[model samples]
Target: MACLGFNPAKIRNQNLHYSKPSSKIVPSSKPIKIKPSPSQFSFKLHCLKSNSVSEAPLSPTEPQISEQEEEVDDPASELSFLDPEIDPESITEWELDFCSRPILDIRGKKVWELVVCDSTLSLQYTKFFPNNVINSITLNNAIASISDDLGVPLPEKIRYFRSQMQTIITKASKELGIKPIPSKRERYETVYQRHPGFQKGAKPFLTLDNPFPMDLPDNLFGEKWAFVQLPFSAVQEEVATLKRTFTFGASFDVELLGIEIDDKTLIPGLAVATSRAKPLAAWMNGLEVCSIEADTARGCLYLSVGISTRYIYATYKKTPTTTGEAEAWEAAKKACGGLHFLAIQEDLDSDDCVGFWLLLDLPPPPV
Candidate 1:
């Protein structure tokens, strides 16, 4: 008996031949036909369906978007956005002069303009006291006339004319003697009756024996004593200086006129009726005649040269009497000099009354 040896190469060749021949062989009989169920077909279709819907056609949506866009682009809508930027409060008082002045329309545009000889004068003071501030008024009448031609308002135009007239009068008053007068009123009867040796009929009631002084709490009284008197030639210079400082030449054309000077004898010991009485008397004796009647008529001058006569008098504490008040009225008359004295009345029944008096400068004669 003999053992058989395995042939590895022969076995490998046989396995290769079997694998190759089976892969190449074709089936002899026809394949059986099969059909899928409807459920299975539906499931396959669902899996293949698109995730997102297709957009609608352009015609329907485009017109709506365009109409909405046009509304937002309207001109009126644009104007509404700009309204808040132009607020009136942003304008200042000085700028109001442009509004008050005559408006000029050229090339369909509006503007306010002025011309002045002395620009400095134009820079100060408004047509009204505090409110209507002008940048600078023109001194030249021609320029002002030009402004008028441009349809500027009358009030604004006249302010310049009046200011110039005032300057001239103020200058003339300096050449002549004139002054501002104190305007305080007080009563004399009670004060005089209280005094010793006060006679009902005596000459010069405003003499040293009787004096009207300020009657106010010391704290409220101003340090400068206010006196009532006729202004001297030098007074105009002082007024000009004052105009430069306080009012800025606003009321320069004002004057005092219609002055009537008189001297009367009264009870010598009677207390001076008004705080202004003594100073008024002094002013009457010192008045200078106005050189130019035209200038004098402007009412540019104050009724009296009101100065601080005495600090002590300004701070006096005694209550005023009726006679004392009458005396004060007389003093105002004297201070007014050329101007007639109107009746004096207490403004209020308080210490403040002693400090306030309304002395009107003579009005301009009817034109």
Candidate 2:
């Protein structure tokens, strides 16, 4: 299989509307906008009947510190007051961001900072730096100091989403024997709220705008596809009891979204049947799929993935029937808090799926 480069010009259709985050259930007449930022690149392979999905809370001995640990003017001073005995469930993986904040320092320049936290956010460490000194070596030293001061073991992996900072982050992680993964699934840091610059409410310093949709490799295209839907209860039950060898992509408890998912509510989705099922599924597995969008006017379906990458996953000739299906998909997705799915199979008759991705257009974090 050949690795294809992302070419934005290939599918830059101006007719497509990029959605902004919204909470209202979009009517069929409105263009639904479900804007969620980057997602984690996590592909799982386990039997549906054999494996159970869940999130485990941090261990009991670990203190549940404030979501964002206290921040100070000086990075070095952080080590002085931090409880050396602070433990957070033996966290082995961390989310990292060494970026400028929405605030500025007394020097009339934006403050740069290195922020680190585990997935559950039970452990958080932050340090502010002057712009000139932001480098891999500085990052490496800060991480080392945090490890020594907290008596916590160094993480095995550090995940960061800012692609521009990949080189520096990778260099720092490699020097410390940690694997670095670029993923969009990092949570926004709330520590900035305490800063004076944000007291009046300011936009994030760094945000990935939605890029133009690109084309999938021609060879991996599916033969047949359709807009589909199923009751939420059926989908949830199948996920729990279905007999399957493997599945991958995003999965989370509906309760975590803060939106109630009524059992009988209909959930919209896309289903593809093709001889290239395995390969198509394989390619998608590598991506952090965000959500699927339908353009009723153009009669096309777009796949939103990674931090802000979009793809022309499929297109249909403009017809009333096709346009109606697209509208229904958009309307249903909006009704369900931007929840949707993608399923790949050899053909409609096949009892098993090559892949299934539970995609969501996540709402923006609270202010």
**Candidate of highest TM-score:** 2
Against the unseen true structure, what C-alpha lDDT does each candidate score? Answer: 0.22, 0.59
lDDT of 2: 0.59
Q: What is candidate 1's CA lDDT for residue 205?
A: 12
lDDT per residue for candidate 2 within 137-256, as digits (tens), equals 999998888778666788998887676688999999999999987765632332344344432455555665567888866754677765556667766754653235456444555543
Tens-digit lDDT track of model 1 for 294-367: 11122111222222221122112222322233244334333433222111112111111111112333322111
Model 2 bad stretches (over 4 Å): 1-93, 120-127, 145-156, 186-194, 199-204, 237-246, 257-259, 349-351, 363-367
Clash pairs, model 2 backbone: 38-184, 39-184, 39-185
Off by over 4 Å in 1: 1-230, 245-329, 332-367
RMSD, one per candidate, in order: 51.7, 12.2
**TM-score of the candidate numbered 1?**
0.20
Report the lDDT of model 1 for residue 80.
9
TM-score of each: 0.20, 0.65
